[model samples]
Target: MDDIQPADIRLMRNEGSLRDFLRLQMTNGKARNAPAKPPPPPQPSDHTPGAWPTGSRPPRPIPQAPPGAWEAALHRLHTDTQTGTRCECPGCDPTTGSHPDAA
Candidate 1:
């Protein structure tokens, strides 16, 4: 009675009994205590950004050719001064088929 206020009286429609108010409070309390619904499982899509898939290694950092071939051609021109375009690394870096250290 002392806890009841004028606003509570208005909520009770001024005609409902105290039992009705208590029932309403109990209903609200139960609603608040109800377990929240679990979040939906992850949607099937491409890998999650940078997250790695299980039992899988990170992606290999493959060397990508530049947008243009000029740099590559220039590199061959400068480094293969003697072999020209014949330098194939381990094949003929010095125009020798054997490893430089082996010789």
Candidate 2:
């Protein structure tokens, strides 16, 4: 018996030749020796310790407002007077016998 050369092996694998036979052999070999798929990932269960109940979500913590919030807001409003204008109403007009502080 003679040993086959690389050129001869390539020629046997050319189009419409022994290529399909070689591919089939490789596929069958892989199917026979491939490892089984790992078990499905563990699922969360109600019976499991520390597991949340089904169809329910964990409670979210309530947010708290800081102390003196109202006083801080009032301070901001009083200091932010860029839009302030003198009242010109008859009751509040300083020129119509009304004090400027009345406005």
Candidate 3:
């Protein structure tokens, strides 16, 4: 029988083919009938409290857009209307030089 290392078993598990590999190993007398040992639990860290368990820093808060964003957008829209760029709605084509809202 070929010598199979524990690392090979771990590799098979990581590759998501452990079940089929284990069956083949059993058939070939390379593996025992006993169940495999489970992986060890994650160790706790003594770093910053409320931080992520993986030792990575917590995510920063998303910054809010400027308070005048909507006002600035509206101002741009008003400027566009004053530039004779008529709205391209069904009957408001600017090429015809006629505006649906014009009296």
RMSD (Å) of each candidate, 1 decimal: 14.0, 10.6, 14.8
- List pairs with backbone clashes in candidate 2: none
**Candidate 3 global lDDT:** 0.63
Estimated TM-score per prediction?
0.30, 0.33, 0.27
Tens digits of lDDT, candidate 1, 7-83: 88787776767677789788988998999999988965765767777568877998888775654564354345444
Candidate 3, residue 100: Cα displacement in angstroms equals 12
lDDT of 1: 0.62
lDDT of 2 by residue, 1-103 (tens): 1475877668877755677756877898899899999998877554566777677788989877799776545443342134374343333323233443545
lDDT of each: 0.62, 0.59, 0.63
Return the number of clashes found in candidate 3. 0
Full-model lDDT, candidate 2: 0.59
Number of the candidate with higher TM-score, 1 or 2: 2
